[model samples]
Target: MAKIAFILLCHKDPDAVINQAQSLTAVGDCMSIHFDARAPRAQFDTIRDALKTNPNVTFATRRVKCGWGEWSLVQATLHALHAAVAQFPDATHFYMLSGDCMAIKPAQYVHDFLDRRDVDHIESFDYLTSDWIKTGWREERLVYRHWFNERTQKKRFYAMFELQKRLGLTRAIPGDITVMIGSQWWCLRRQTVESILEFRKQRPDVMRFFRTTWIPDETFFQTLVRHLVPERDIDSRTLTFLMFTDYGMPVTFHNDHYDLLLSQDFLFARKISAEAHDLRRRLGVLYACEGARFRISNEGRSLFTFLTGKGRTGHRFAPRFWETESTLGRERDLLIVLCRKWHVARRLVDCIRTSTGLPCIGYLFNDESCALPDLGGIQDSMDKRHRHRRALLRMLYEHYDSDRLLICLDPSNLDLIEDFCRDRSVTRLLEIDCDFSDRDLIEHAMRVGLAGDGTPPETLARLLPTIRNDMALETDTLRDRNFAHHSRLREADPPARNARAIAAFLDCSEPIAGALATTDQLFAE
Candidate 1:
């Protein structure tokens, strides 16, 4: 049987890392770990000692003192990959993973899957065109030289980043290279892995360029693969399942997420915490019982409808939201704006903010547009993206003060508004609905390249019906809203539309002049 190599990167959870490594070793896979150099000596020794007896296990000699959004993260991964390739020359495929990741498939099945496939299981997309570019920051990552180090005073660093951004100081992307970004975890063929190492040795300039780039791990290998070996088939989806909150923070996987995990076709699931003993135990039992089939349980079958909306024009699975209470005890009025069309919702957010004189923050669930403010923070890894989002959410909730608040979020994240209110003891739930047919949303999505791969029509044919069903289900859930599409809400004139929607939802006696002015100006332009 062909052997596989596992490159495991870890920082905080040594025990979980060891347990995961031991589990993988059962199938006789070679393992190499790159513990963060910033981690304490005691933690490192504990992990080292736990796996010391395992002859197949190796450690990266040059551990990196990793920092978020710095070159160190990529360097650490490179160190591990190099060490693994050197020690396990016979290994056929190498799987890059984190300490928190756990296998959902049997070792034999995973081995078979890798052995049979010639394609590299890596997610890669043109950074310029990807829908998640959020605020042209993707362009800035490559175009600007990030000067502020993450270890210093963050407030000052962010101020500096903004100052630089305002100054329009940007560098041109290298003529020879096209930047690509995607999920960091990947399973690469040994040859592909070796090629990357060789390329890195030959091209120090490219490596240096990426060193200052934000979240380069998401792009470095992916960009190199596309440039060096375009002929090599690449699968754009990762096998690891990670659940995120409305704010883009990773939701901790607990017992409730078990069925959710089983519903996916992924071989592994990430972000399993050390505290999830029951879930870990159940996972072990699942692998032992089912081997590689990865069948959904009878109970989980019932959840399938919930997981993937069915029987609707556009079915929408219930998007998960993490519930956290705000510390503020004072009750504030909330203007909840929910819609499937993000662009429309975004406009509505601006209208509501102007109308209510409250700042609006959109929690995007779908990949609609990439224009977002470039958040100034260094991420040590791609996994930290959610952490940054969570921090952003906390900061906004804690710092922003107003009598009224306008929140623009994807329809999928509507439940979060309820959680937010409940935490703040707000009794009134004012819901504003944006009206658009499933067809309209689908058409817009297809136009924006959100539907799927290929040409609009082809991708539409492939993805529209499913998305339509999802939207229909979502619409149904929000059917009881104060305002809705194809209802009395649509009767208003175009110039007074947003004002009417707000008036109708909030039951206000008078229209806010700001909203009317914005609507008039928007229509005029």
Candidate 2:
């Protein structure tokens, strides 16, 4: 018996909007669309004509010229809500969405899910205690008057804001309202929507106050709903699954994210690309289906959190060809293995992996093959670029979730080697002296294309000394190769000797004999 009246604020992509309108109306739901006044008149006409025959669809009479972070956005939503309420008397709930939002679940599933719960689904958090807003003005946004649109009239906006600040001009919220902040997208029960509109009519002064507030759209309805509705009747979370970047920009969904979107428990997703025709078509088919349960999976959330949250290691300096600065932050429990020979590095990594059960990666900076074999075919998927390499390292650090990560690097990778040595995160720097003659080092360098002429050998000659100097100045734990440890690592049963040395370096409490036994099994591989 429950029905949803979807209010959409559209700016562009009339065709996509039309598709969404038709799909929602097909299930007996009503739709009210408010196309931005700034958009081309032709686009509005096209959408209106396409949905003219559908009795469930209506358009707001007043088209507000909406701008980012302006009061007009809320005005547009209100215009559409008024129209929807007047036209669809039987509608039980109001769901707010945008032109790019699409139903990730079936329409029937959404209706049933909402009908089962009487609580309104919207993200409302106490602005003072919450860290929701990533950047820009927070408490000041409400305390000061914002007269100009921040996007279009940036200079006037800031100038007026600063002028007000200097003049000590401040405003206080009405005593009756408790300010809350959240995402602009929301779903409200019909009663709650009517209460909000009724409050707007009764409190014109409060509405005017919000008009002068910055980014009022995010705060206006959120503050009102909390003030009008009982705390028990509200669920402080959005039904729409929206993600933002570290810089507070929405992450746009593309065709490849179709499966990920389906895995979320949220009924809808926003900011979908208009050109993702395949994603739209597939989701449209799924939306029209009946009796289909929402598929819940954490893979999407896990991947998103890894990419957006934990993956950002806060490395101050990105790797650049001409830049010599090291990555800024200290990586805890990280070990850098610098060696000239690939086989020797491989053996050392294998010995450590077997002995300590630690995660070890080989040739992380190598352009030839996948550095992370555990990820399976990731190297082929992305281009061999500095950014991609940095991403890979971030993923490796996050994926292992261990106390220690062992990374092997060829000494010829001077840029990466220098950066790693200077990085505070690297706890241990192990330089293995394989005792290769100058001719051998030169030959190996030439094979790897590092020997462009005379430059490489000179660079290679200074590599160890420079690293030693950096370690002495920057770090407390630097293990240089002495004759005893080198001889042990190069012995006939080198894996056992290598394991003992590594165990000692790491200060492992385990018996050396046990580690030696494990090293034999590793060599059998």
Candidate 3:
């Protein structure tokens, strides 16, 4: 009979909080919830009235105005923890959770699991030695005093930090306490919770010191639990299943993640989106009905493993069936066309489409306009287009059923151009040199204004050598472009030489070659 007490800290979304509180009460667990003082009074009253009839639910007497990356979060947690402990004396375990968290496992299963293991389940690691703090200030987090809210008042925060640095103001951690860093979520046994409360009561100076430290909610309880509990008695892992993006933001669970949630052995999951009504209802039903019968499947675990590994390596694209086809052999048909002038590139793509009757797309990576009607949504932002460039190419490659797929790219897109040149899947790269000199480009930009958005002189100067080097490493499919010779030849007879080059690169049949050769007017400057 291991009864559990839950300490829920919430700021917004009263409906979600009420649902979670009701779910826990239905399972016979007592909970104390603390709403942020900054939240709307109506929201707090709504949640309180919704669960007022349930004797297992209690609201904290003290509410704190919480801010992100501040000490008020810890204050809120402490308030709720104190209320829960005082109200539910028979509870054997105390769990800290957010308003967005929901139980993914049966109450009996959780109770039995805790009954078997007498250790506290929390994520605690030595910050100095561990690689957990990936991209932020590590030692500086503790040594520097962060008086301002880093999220809301970033300018003031950085200003104060710099002033402190220049003035040689630094704080030292107490010699008696070892600073440990971990997630804010934890599940502690009654004895561990009691010890932590007692420690907090006795150590006022330490708490005051941490009040100025960065994100004390994550480090406060984590450092104390390690000081109180022995190494063998702690699990050093959170009972809540959580995942974060590369930017360190939590990934919200949605309806599509139902199968993924079933695979996890953790008793609860957090940061569940408010819009995920179906997912929440289904998980609640499963928790109530299935209980221990809900078995973990290998499919979910395998998918999670693949997603996690791929996410780490920056392969964030969703795997498609055509991607499998690409691995088999479909990649050989891929062809990339590079040119500085969009109109010339468009003419070349048209010629290729007429000659080969294959899927030839024009300006696939163009920031302004794309040939594909369906790609309008992704063409709005240059950064987004660059990020999803590979995935878009793959989708187009699979969209049109043909032996060859041709894509037109502007040489100004050096990043994508480099990727295309190095890609083994791209069997051919046709670089059509329109022979526009730096003076010609500048004059054109001046005449046409923004319409002639050609590459700048400095960029073109840097781009030409890089392209030559990249083309040198490429296979024979990339024909050598002697710019000087091409310039001399184009000065003599521009249309004929350009037509011959296009026909030669495509390896067109006799009839198509004749059609392309006569279409010399399309190559006129």
Candidate 4:
């Protein structure tokens, strides 16, 4: 088979991409990469070093900012494509790839698909025909995002839908605002890629639109291919969709279908077990693993999507997926508890053994519940004596007695944690004060799934702690337009000199944090 070129777009994905590159190399594909120029030089240096050992790998000297709804990412792709064409002029086919995508099918199948492919058969070009622009489409399509944000999105959506409807789009008798997924992963015959690049050189307008469109890469590649060759051998149905509802890897069971896909090198998947031995133990699984990726469990895979990079794409491939027969059976889970809020329960819980020396898990809901949605309209006035205890329920059944859980607490909500520890068989509880670690909002934004709606002083307390800066507790809240003021314990405010620390050891802004002392400025003893 002639050589296939892999164009991998990435940022902070060295490990996964490198591993997949290992697989591709084993299967024999020449690789080129475009690392985001926006990343600090250190990242590129590391990536270049990691792949320096690969003979067929080429690194781009030109890097660009890969914006989400902007033309930047498109420019980078074209630039890389130009570079890849120069280096591998003899390469027969080009496969656009991403750090997150792994090829589970045998290379021969892909090679065969490309060998029969013609230069005319691609999606992106035909959409650019002379008739296309006459349909009131030009660089305006690049500004499609104006239809996405603030003022004009709703109007633009209906207008565009009406226009497409007016165009007699066959895919929908009604109108479905459909666009190809993305060129983050696509395959093109070498001649076709060359022609597209040549076309790009000739038509500055086409190229400009590609550069500025919110989703340029996908549109450029797919639109051209579809435009030029609507009759191409695109296996739209052959593309498989996988969802890993299990843990690590599939339980080995001999079945002919599985064997056939493995033998023929087609994509078929089974259930797997996903487990992490270090800090948390997520044993067994509730679903199946399709590819060597995707970690699925009883919690299903939605909550774990971001952690594992499961995008909106319909196809899935979890190479490490497996199935488990639960002795526990199909049962619903209930409740979660936080163990550092209540002092009555806090005194009963050995605060020495939680948080620092121990892994004290916690939950807190303070300030107000006016924000929470309710099922029964249950409230302080809903029951007798105007009392309805509204609260969040957290359940912890798997208890590790020997392991200590140091719980950092919010002073105002101390009762929640203390009560939880008292009810559960906890080995020990060490409560620490807050530290207020909010300086790194870049990473925080992604982990917390912020709506990006410009809500100030957003309460991100529920976000996973792995990515959270402990700063929920401190900062000047006396008056700020971004967020409302919180109680002292939640703000990481330092205690008065000679004042007792009320929360976790790291609670104070500076000095000794979470050090236990009485209100008298001395040990209770």
Alpha-carbon RMSD to native, per candidate: 16.7, 14.7, 17.9, 20.6
How far out, in Å, is residue 389 in model 4? Answer: 44
| Predicted model with the maximum lDDT | 2
Cα lDDT listed for each candidate = 0.65, 0.73, 0.72, 0.42
Summed backbone clashes in each candidate are: 17, 3, 0, 96
Which candidate order results from sorting by TM-score in descending order?
2, 3, 1, 4
Per-residue C-alpha lDDT of model 3 across residues 281-305, encoded as one tens digit per residue: 8777655553455454323333334
What does the lDDT read for residue 238 in candidate 1?
77
For model 2 the local lDDT of residue 232 reads: 96
Once fitted onto the true fold, the runs of candidate 2 whose alpha carbons sit more than 4 angstroms away are: 305-511, 514-525
lDDT tens per residue, model 1, 1-525: 657788888998777777777777765788989999899989999999999999789999698988777777889999998889988888888888888787777777676777676878888889888874554365767776664555654776577677778998777676898888888888888888999999998988887788878778888988988887665577777777766543556656776566556645677888886788988877765543434454432222222333344443343233334323323345555455555555655665576665555666664323324333444542223334333433444444455645454555565654554344444434233333444555675665544435322223433354456666666666666665443222223313454554555565555545463254245333221
Candidate 1 vs 3: which has more lDDT: 3
lDDT of 4 by residue, 1-525 (tens): 657777777766565556556556555567778888877888788778888888777765488867564566666777777777887777776766555444434566555545653443223333334342233445445433222422335576557656755775323111221233332345667766777778777767565445534445546667555444444445332222134434533232122222122222222222211121211111111011222322111121222344344223232222112211211112312122222224322442334333234333332243232222233443223231112121222111223322222333343233333333233232122333323334434333433443122222222233335233223332221113131111123223344421232332223322333343322222121
Off by over 4 Å in 3: 297-525
RMSD in angstroms, candidate 2?
Answer: 14.7
Q: In angstroms, give how far residue 431 of model 3 lies from its true place.
A: 27
**Leading candidate by TM-score:** 2
Order by lDDT, highest first: 2, 3, 1, 4
